[model samples]
Target chain A: MKRAAAILGIGTDHVYEVDPDESGRVSAEKMEEKILYCQELGFSVFFVGITAGTTVYGAFDPIEDIAIICRKYKIWLHVDGAWGGSALLSPKTKHLLQGIDKADSFTWNPHKLMSIHLQCSAILIRHTNILMQANQMCAGYLFQPDKHYETSLDTGDKTIQCGRHIDILKLWLGWKARGHQGYAEHIETLLEKANFFYEIISKREPCFRMVIKPPFINVCFWYVPPSLQNIDQTSLEYNERLDKIAPRIKERMMTNGTMMVGYQRLDHHPNFFRAIISNPATTKDDIIAMIDEIHELGHDL
Target chain B: MKRAAAILGIGTDHVYEVDPDESGRVSAEKMEEKILYCQELGFSVFFVGITAGTTVYGAFDPIEDIAIICRKYKIWLHVDGAWGGSALLSPKTKHLLQGIDKADSFTWNPHKLMSIHLQCSAILIRHTNILMQANQMCAGYLFQPDKHYETSLDTGDKTIQCGRHIDILKLWLGWKARGHQGYAEHIETLLEKANFFYEIISKREPCFRMVIKPPFINVCFWYVPPSLQNIDQTSLEYNERLDKIAPRIKERMMTNGTMMVGYQRLDHHPNFFRAIISNPATTKDDIIAMIDEIHELGHDL
Candidate 1:
């Protein structure tokens, strides 16, 4: 979203919760807030960065009729699917990105979730000549009349950088090596693992309070340590204590080099340990071990 | 001029030399004619691509200053020195590019003559904050609001391309390897070669014509073939014959593989061959061979 906004010179975006609200569909409320904010600020452009958790907080469009309101207002809508966009391939989840076709631009990162190496992101425009219009430099040596056809959009020109690395070679090879079915199956396995963790952790004795139980792969949970037994804890205070605890736990986990997890504050909460399992190398045993280690780390506290 | 105008979202620039009086420098008279033409056509910008023999046309400053003299002019002067800007290294030749400092933006390619690699070109602004202001994007993964440097410029963001290749690495390494003194010496050798070529080619014969020979590297000349004895023909008709002879002669020379030379029509004048000697591998003998090949090629014409 930042790269696209910088390149095209317009728009602001807000992160969307991947899961649905109480209604069993992705809530458009956060998007609505951002849109209203853009309106308040008099901006004509809006972008949405959508990722995991669609089942809990965000479902796709409930009615196709919202397209009518958007067209009436004339806001240039863009979808930033740098990671979760790969889910577009799955029949079960494609509906979650329902009104996406109405967007003016879509930025998808093949590098992130798609097993491709770093830096294979593309911002595809829907309408006419845009990238070229934004970044054409008639460099005499680089773009001479004699050899114009050989110039493959000079992708360097449209980009916000000069002399960009050629990431297409890796993507082209990946497509040739692993067909769509293989990638879909990989995604399915990850989803299954995510769901398995949710089931186990929810039932465990020293339970994790899931700020988001994660419809997809991102799982956020706080450890209710024994040291906080006497304190009347609000969600904010517990989160603050978790913030103090999360880093030391995460660092200790990293020293082993066997299991890895993500830890960060999402929304208003402070540091809770979030397991974002993008690496397929992880197994159920590793997850159990991590949870056990977290419990051990928090027991004395 | 074209690439940058395109980068800045301007359209095609009709590339035509305003050298009516046939002086190498753009004279005040030519400037007057160009200004009149631009105004007649209702142009808001003037891009100046500086070159040698530019004195005959008039120095860029007086011409640009007079263009600035035109009222209500939003003329954004851009100086494109993808070749000759290296003159800044020398005190003497530096005067040639005097008012270039006043340009809104200047583009100079180190790759062309400064012995840098393919993409080591730069567009320098006196104060470059405007460029950052123009290309800012609010990307989460890239530009974050965390406790790092915020206002400081990352060279990456200022570019139009993302996932940038480190083209500057070679230039930086070269600068470090061969300090400024080494580069200046290389430039001095280039000056010597330019003077050498100017001396040699000018001495060739009446059959040869020197169009623009400066102290710098570019030396353009026309090969006027003698028709068996003394037959004068139109330069256009003469060049049409020479064109057919030159390439066939060049093919045989290339087959020998001792050398190669680039020949092209300059400024719509079919009367000349442009001999650009920026390559460090070139020598006095190579210049001699180039002249010999053209002369030998002319005999058959």
Candidate 2:
């Protein structure tokens, strides 16, 4: 999003990031405040983007409140649901994204949660005519008027690209094979696994420290080694040592071909692991094995 | 390229296009005149793009002269060799791109003449460091410093795309299967077929008007019927009648599944067919069959 804005001549200073709460979800009040501040400065609020599911933590932003603000300001609301948009298919969790229809535009990558092949993503706009107006390049040679069929169906002018890979076929076929009900069941199962992992990690006490309650399918926690279990986390030495643990464990995991997990330090927080359960095939045993493997690899450190 | 410049806040009025010569290649003098004019208007001449092989007529721009002008003005010279870059492998035609080594950047599509699968294109830059400097985004989560392997090998930082398809393997394996010598032979064969087709069309006189001697593997000619042979080509009625022939023949070809050819009206020229011989399997018999099929389909018209 920053790169896109930068490309359009928007400086980094103009891009204001509204911070997320303790649960990693952006606050509705904070967003409204930012919008009001921008208006006060006589700036036209053109775009307001809400991350439906953040990459580090699979937390959904409060879409209902964001949509209301967008409507009031007449700003284009874009929902970046690249990671968690598939959850809308699940009847149980669809309420998480209740006001998704109000968004002016939304981006959803089927490859992530749906487990479809990579490079399958859709950017849907509520006003498709606006999209055409922005992208149409009437190249005379390709989009010919003398075609036998309807020329409106020639989608070449509707995209920034002249030639695009046929990635939609794979996504369409995969969706057909696994019906809507199948996807809902898969999403529900993955969330259940995440909750199950969270419970186990909580019971393990000092060995594993839960960063936050499992919001979506992402369970972020720090695998506290025996040496740092008793130390104050806010201490400089403790954080310095904690930062090195995930990288070292990741190195060992790669060498042994064991379980794989991602780790990153957000803001002032120390390095912590982010375990995502997107694959429905991932069993409870697999989650348990990951915890055991991390312990075994980083016990000495 | 215009759209990209527009996005970067450069208006259409700022863009100046120098017309190509009668041979469809941009003349060096015309290019220099445009550059001097832009400079006179107090515009910073940033880029000058030369089409190595024009789509309508496969004409090679005088790269040697253009490169010298670019050097003199300290401007970036980008060669759009998307259609004809593969000719570099052929010993006979490599001289056409004599000063390609001096170009600041060049775009080549392996999908065109190389017969590699679609979506395989490369932009070769003279300065590798500048590319990295322009594209590098220090994303903390992805480009980690503590990686086991050399992190510099991670190409993710050096591209605009976050997730890219693994297209390199196909190009690499295809290049390996057919070595440099094999490509040279293939290119030479295609050029020979193009010349053969040109000779055949030239013999047919008024029935097939040759659209300049093809510089590359594109054989462009008008498949004029017997009725329009005596008419002056410059006449409005003649051009109007001539424009209808290719489309009518194309419709018949599609319905009969005899042969497929592309047609377009370039500049002030009437509608003409552009037959390309990129396929290695194309034989003299196939070329003869196409000519016979066109006559059979459009003889009465």
lDDT of each: 0.59, 0.85
The candidate scoring highest on DockQ is 2
Global Cα lDDT for candidate 1: 0.59
- Candidate maximizing TM-score: 2
Q: For model 2, name the residue pairs that clash.
A: none
Tens digits of lDDT, candidate 2, B146-209: 8788877778778777887777777898889999999999999999999899999988887888
If you superpose only chain B onto the true chain B, what TM-score does each candidate give?
0.80, 0.96
Report the Cα lDDT for residue B133, model 2: 80
The per-prediction CA RMSD against the true structure, in angstroms, equals: 7.9, 1.8
**In model 1, which runs have C-alpha deviations exceeding 4 angstroms?**
A1-301, B2-10, B13-75, B148-157, B206-209, B223-235, B243-260, B271-273, B290-301
lDDT per residue for candidate 2 within A1-301, as digits (tens), equals: 7666666667556787898888888877999999999889988888999988788878899999899988988999999999888889899998888799999999999988888887788998999677568766565555666755576777777877677778888889988998999988989999899999999899888888888887788888888799998898789988899888888888999999987788888767677899998888889899888888888998888
Q: Score the docking of each candidate (DockQ).
A: 0.13, 0.53
